[model samples]
Target: MGTAERINSSQRTLPYVEIMDSTLRDGEQTNGVSFLPHEKLMVARMLLHDVNVDRIEVASARVSEGEKEAVRMICRYADQIGKLDRVEVLGFVDGHLSVDWITDCGGKVINLLAKGSLKHCTHQLQKTPENHIADIKETVEYATSKGLSVNLYLEDWSNGMKDSPEYVYQLMDELSSVSTIKRFMLPDTLGVMNPLQVIEYFRKMIKRYPDIHFDFHAHNDYDLAVSNSLAAVLSGAKGLHVTVNGLGERCGNAPMASVQAILKDQFHAKTGIVEDQLNGISRLVEGYSGIAVAPNQPIVGENVFTQVAGVHADGDTKDKLYYNELIPERFGRKREYALGKNSGKANIAKNLEELGLELTPEQTKRVTQRITELGDKKEIVTQEDLPYIVSDVLKHDAPEDKVKLISYVVSTAYGLKPGANIKVEINGQQYDGSAVGDGQYDAFVKALRYIYKKYLNRTFPILANYQVSIPPGGRTDALVQTVITWHYNDGLLRTRGLDADQTEAAIKATFKMLNIVESNL
Candidate 1:
């Protein structure tokens, strides 16, 4: 088929496309990312059971004992859940070596790798297309004989179609008759193809091999993986290969969350992905990979659902004018209105509603002004900080805090456990406590816990998370901001504090948390 003819042809709609996650295999190719065996098992279980992707490629055959162990563990878990066939491993066409390695690890499926382009066949593998085909057939035969289903990867398939269409055809023609080969995975190995090229090339492949199940694997070198993936689907590809948080070699692969979102929201296509679990899995992968997800990244980013402008917040109240099909609730997240220089009264009102606080028009104006001033100075104000901002703005109207910090002294010496002495007032009753701990912050928390438990006969909230940050530019004298998350009454509460010292900032945040708890009581 010619390019124009293929491009102009009627587009086909797929009711559903299979999702094959390669976070453990191809995603591990990302530099400085190596999941421990247990971590690999956790990710696999989550992908297969919780997120419920159609398939998972767990590891490459024979990489290391560690890789082998990870694959084995994943396979065992999958088998226990009756999902053994959904777990696949990448293997080479080296006769029976790759196949044997996979079968030894209890893998039920092998995705066989083969050279797709004439350049790769002749230069990289130093073999003609005929030689490469023979190796692949041998491996497929062996893998089938061992009772394992097989899929074939056309490595560098994008360049193969562009530079050597004849070679690609010859290989496909030879392998199309292999009943044992379940799927043909076409990869843009160098991340070179644009969406237009993808549509053109994919149409040709689908037209020539109508009976074949083709899975498109994309890379993000040009930041076009998601677009190319959509194009491939629109052009009739039956499956897609993706990684969590786009973790792969070089730039990365198409991220699972993004691909799923676009498929559902843009194309109106269906998949097995559990949309609500996308954010949780993304965070899990981010923690394991030590690669941070950008705050502005779509769907799973920290700020994607936050409205930063006053007009946007106003529009939201007027009928959700700024909302789209990608609602945060679909992915287990909530929309937030940011309080900053650009945030007008609408944003403040929205935040106040979330906190269950109602204020007079004039009181809200004062609070908005204070927030804007803080924002102009580049200070971050979260929804958790709104109550404090309101209390400060309308001091006479605000009630006295039920809890307050009187004093605290934390000390650390080279060879001794850190010690803390603390005095606090709760409902006007003063209490003193002292304790030793592994660190200064730990000591301080221990002292507070001692006071709460011994004097007040109360259970302290569990410290769920703590984060500290300073202004950019590596300024040593910059003020520190501490944010702490606490688990109280079967829910989570967050508080923020700012100070010149890190410990002091954390202590301030702790006091805020205590007051919040006391107020509820």
Candidate 2:
């Protein structure tokens, strides 16, 4: 039987691993990440209602008044929806201060942070094990009186397990008797534990306290957060702590998408997460956190589902031989075949199929070779570039000339704005325009736009992004490749040019864009 089937058949008996997302709380610990009160509320709603994560940690107690307001806003909305239990806030073991702060904000749950390592307990808090236990007990009792559910976070539990097992055991043994404690949360605070260590240590905790509920939280200091989280689950952890986009302090935490994928695909464990919403939430978090997700980042990254190699595309075309169980469709994404130097005829054919165009074998070979040549020059050959590339390689001249640059002059002076004068032939008529701008390229584009608007009585495409690069370790005079992306009515169009001067290269790319947009019109 499949893992899901096996787990489902024994549904009531199998352990259901609950996911607690801490993007707003721990994730905000990322350097330079601070969410406004309204942003925090919006994220909480999305995580709870849209993504359907089991729980969400929204903020820490007593951090700031802004944090208080954010927590209150999230709590108010959560209360209205009968999901108040699903929202949690991190608290400290500081008597009733954190508890009182949470209570004032209408929070129903508190994830109380306690020192797990012997060094932390002795040096950081300057308290004996007996005193620390007494403090935690007092806080739990006070929180329970306020009708708040409590979960304990054993901070630095991984290091504690390794360096001071007796103290960790003493702490757990003491806290396990508290009836108000809903879960005993263990965190690899320093991210020092590996998969094997996680399995062994987590299993030891489970065996010793078989009746206690455990939630495993991981850090990515060593890039093993996801692996350690999976190990925890396999060793009988009933809950996991996660952050969207893996945003956290230092190296961050295990990413939610990766953890979800591993749980479902590898372990057959079920979660409340809606797989399709993963990408949407990831993007949302990426924006709010100001952390750019790596293009190769698993599941939600831009290039994860894209095939860049021709052989891989050919294999996928045949029988999906290059496909993995982590299909892009599972996350509301599509598989894309990239066009570049490595793209063979099969890759060209795939792109052609998408564009609803077909070419003979000879045409295909020529187009592929041209694309390879462009790629060798470190220029990206996007699918939108295919028509121009085909026209260039096939030597199709007459129809391709919609707008052509006749002559242009650019000047720059110290402490003065750059200026440009451009002459262009559009539809076989010459138009001249001059403009001053922030830079030479900007000035050139401004002149082009002026000619299009005033002379031709037509609007031009908006320049969306412009990137320039030269081969690494090249001389100062090496060819500079400029790729310009333009937002047109149809879609985004990218055109590339190569020249010794950066401004000239950008101008060349812009000219290509004008002609392409003219042809489309």
Residue-level lDDT tens digits of model 1 in 1-521: 88655544523345589999999999999999999999999999999999999999999998999999999999999999999999999999888898999999999999999998999999999998998999889889999999999999999999999999999999999999999999999999999999999999999999999999999999999999999999999889999999999999999999999999988876778899999999989989999998999999989998899999999999999989999999999998778888899999999999898778999999999999999999988778877788878878887555677888888889888899999999888899999999999889999999999998999888999997677888534376888889988887765677888889899999989888887777667
In candidate 1, list every pair of residues with a backbone clash: none
Please report how far candidate 1 places residue 196 from its true position, in Å. 1.4
Error of 2 at 341 (Å): 1.1
Model 2 lDDT per residue over 25-89, tens place:
99999999999999898899999999999999999998999999999999999999999999999
Q: Give the TM-score of candidate 1.
A: 0.89
Which stretches in model 2 have alpha-carbon errors above 4 Å?
A: 1-14, 397-521
lDDT of each: 0.91, 0.89
Candidate 1, residue 50: lDDT: 94
